[model samples]
Target: MTQTKKNQQPQPAAQPKPGSAFAYAPAPESRSVVDIAPSYGLFIDGEFSDAADGRVFKTVSPSSEEVLSEVAQAGEADVDRAVRAARKAFASWSALPGSERAKYLFRIARIVQERSRELAVLESLDNGKPIRETRDADLPLVAAHFFYYAGWADKLAHAGFGPAPRPLGVAGQVIPWNFPLLMLAWKIAPALATGNTVVLKPAETTPLSALFFADICRQAGLPKGVVNILPGYGDAGAALVAHEGVDKVAFTGSTAVGKQIARTVAGGSKKLTLELGGKGANIVFDDAPIDQAVEGIVNGIFFNQGQVCCAGSRLLVQESVADEVLDALKRRLSTLRVGDPLDKNTDIGAINSAEQLARITALAEAGEAEGAERWSPACELPSAGYWFAPTLFTGVTQAHRVAREEIFGPVLSVLTFRTPAEAVEKANNTPYGLSAGIWTEKGSRILSVANQLRAGVVWANTFNKFDPTSPFGGYKESGFGREGGRHGLEAYLDV
Candidate 1:
């Protein structure tokens, strides 16, 4: 029974095993279904046109470093044209009966469903997320978001804000890259449902899907100049947000950028809403279900490779079950398959870009430098891609950069808490208030803890579950304003 006795018992030959060191067969999804054009132009005033200065930039696949297409870059002049178009269309668009606008949104949602497979494949190809995620999570949510907002279009009169809220004309929206098309849906759907016209700029790295969305707008027979798409870098976004023609500015990206946009729109008449970053905490109590809690932790941080704004990057586990939970987590991580994103079986895919990958690497290295015990499962990344192994940091302190900053990658920081009060305090310590999760068997404790977590969203037993009917936003520096449901209408309306 002792260590000496156990060491003397097992002696086996070193031989080839069945499942040890197994390699996944290459099962790449066909790109033939997706037809990437050689070049693309700005979608302004319901037509594709060149940049004012004819400047163009190339977009590449982060996974293979292959150039996907050349897209026209928009400058101040192009932004002006798009804004003018949206403004010109706003009068009629907003004046239309809510029923007509609702019908258009309903049509868009139906078309998105009909073309879900094509859109999913295109999103997976343009962004670095796995095909499974694009097909299952992102695309379905995109459609549902449109569908949910469509119903709200005709019902805004009875909403609590006021008897009759007026639409904010010519909304300027900027979206991030993590959930490209989904973010587009989130921004544009609410704006349109409120009868506002939009001039949106998709992230430069992931613009193809948004341009495809422009095609959807045309197919839906959305009025000319009602929706405009501009694909460009930050300068174009700056121009769009600062243009006097824009009455509302909606942005979803970094906290720094959000701050800058806030400053730019300060003292102006433009209304703004920002959905920014987070360092979400997944707290596991002593009396929690260990197995289910472990699964929640994994889904919390590892979904979308932890590129989520509300990812549970910080794990606050009770010291009693810390060892058990971490051991099980490490074992479960070892089974995760990471490789080509096109592979349906791949669990983790490429990083979104070289710059983001570098940021993640630097932050992770800082974690090790700050004396946290860094660990990653034994996994092989492809030679020709941007990939980071699923990582966990144990012995992490409150002051550690990884624990405090938004690493925004497939990295989890594990910290221990002695009591529920300490867990709530540690979770609330961060400036971000996007989301948090609590795992416990006690019903009263879930309510007690959820009430004090200082986050916009709280999940008692599960993690990362989203529904279109639920309004989502954050507090503090994580940014403000709701994105879904009845409350979302306030941002785009004169409530």
Candidate 2:
């Protein structure tokens, strides 16, 4: 991942000179737009209530370590209460006509769009991602998912699943911290669109947006208990998954936890879908556009501070053009601005939490200890928050820990291949098969390599591009089941 800034062209006069008075000013998004409550409770049965045990936890802004708010910590008793509410609501919710359900979904989608800016700001404050990403990427997709599934509510009969598919009773869903509201939209939109009720537990670190979404549901006039939000840690998620009233279980998190959930539901009647971890490979052939490939490489791994499940953490480049790609990548990394999450100019933000920062630091250290050459730009970070510089490791091999493990941070491991066969072999060597990217000018080569890859989703000439109409999931250790498009509808329907 190390690259030299040599042989680069000089900037034109129109561009701001280094250390000049013409340098850009701070253009920060106003935090005044988001009004945070002093404390919050769980959203159950269309009402807010404290956890049965009265346990509470505080959420902090990762950017400045500021206390955002205190949220109720759900326990087993709370899980039981939420599940019971969902079970009670299932009868009428499922009995509603598809056309009527579509109206509710469409209303939710419209409200999401109307309040998207407020939600996006809250997401950045709670999730520690750049405001640009929360505003442009996460918020837009959240609305699109609701709208997409809203269109499918009345069309399930023509979706080829069956003439009349019945709704699963209740879904117990657990989403990770990486994409809070977007993941909620993914799990809840389909479940509700197919006439199933949901009791969802958002990741502990990021819960504000989901709580706000419960407000959106109320504004949409969605029926009571059709969607329940429980903000808590792992214990609450475990309780929800093991609840007997839940007929379906959906989880999006680490692979180890996904395995645990699978074991818990094994031999039971509960239908399950798990979207887990990935160490996706972004392959660059000699014939690919060097500049375009470098941008894609940055966007794939650096977007969201590399916290994405389907991040292109591994870089597999053809040996013939490796030097060119690495040099260009290095030059590009040097220009990235890493700082304030609210700053529109900031390219990289704080890590989600101190724990995640330590994990990333340890893994990067392991890469250096295991003989991978590490390099990072000379970037100064803010003193108060958890932060890590965008890092790169050159001379990485499939055997190296950095290449094999999911770092889930702003780190990229670079590897090289001599031929197409070697590229495919190296890409498929990973146990996780969530995603892979192919960068090449030749359509034939893109099709050929994509066909041979083991990943469930393959991107050609692009990376990290998502659509609500496109199905997304993983294979093997990355987990099973799709979460988007028409295929996503099947997870909630009983044919």
Q: Pick the candidate with the highest lDDT.
A: 2
Model 2: lDDT to the true structure? 0.93
lDDT of 1 at 163: 88
Pairs clashing in candidate 1? Answer: none
Give the Cα-based TM-score of candidate 2 against the true structure.
0.96
- Give the per-residue Cα lDDT of candidate 1 at 52: 96
- Clash count per candidate: 0, 1
After superposing candidate 2, which stretches have Cα over 4 Å from the reference? 1-22
Q: What does candidate 2's lDDT look like per residue over 1-495, in tens digits? A: 122212213234345778743544566777767778878999999999999999999999899898888999999999999999999999999999888998998898889888878888889889889989999999999989988998999999998899999999999999999999999999999999999999999999999999999988899999999999999999999999999999999999999999999999999999999999999999999999999999999999999999999999999999999999999999999989898888777899989999999999999999999999999998889999889999999999889999999999999999999999999999999889999999999999999999999999999989999999999999999999999999999999998
Least well predicted 10-residue stretch by lDDT in candidate 2: 1-10
- Per-residue CA lDDT of model 1 for 146-205, tens digit only, reads 999989888898878788989989999999999999999988998999999999999999
Best by TM-score: 2
* Model 2 Cα shift for residue 88 (angstroms): 0.5
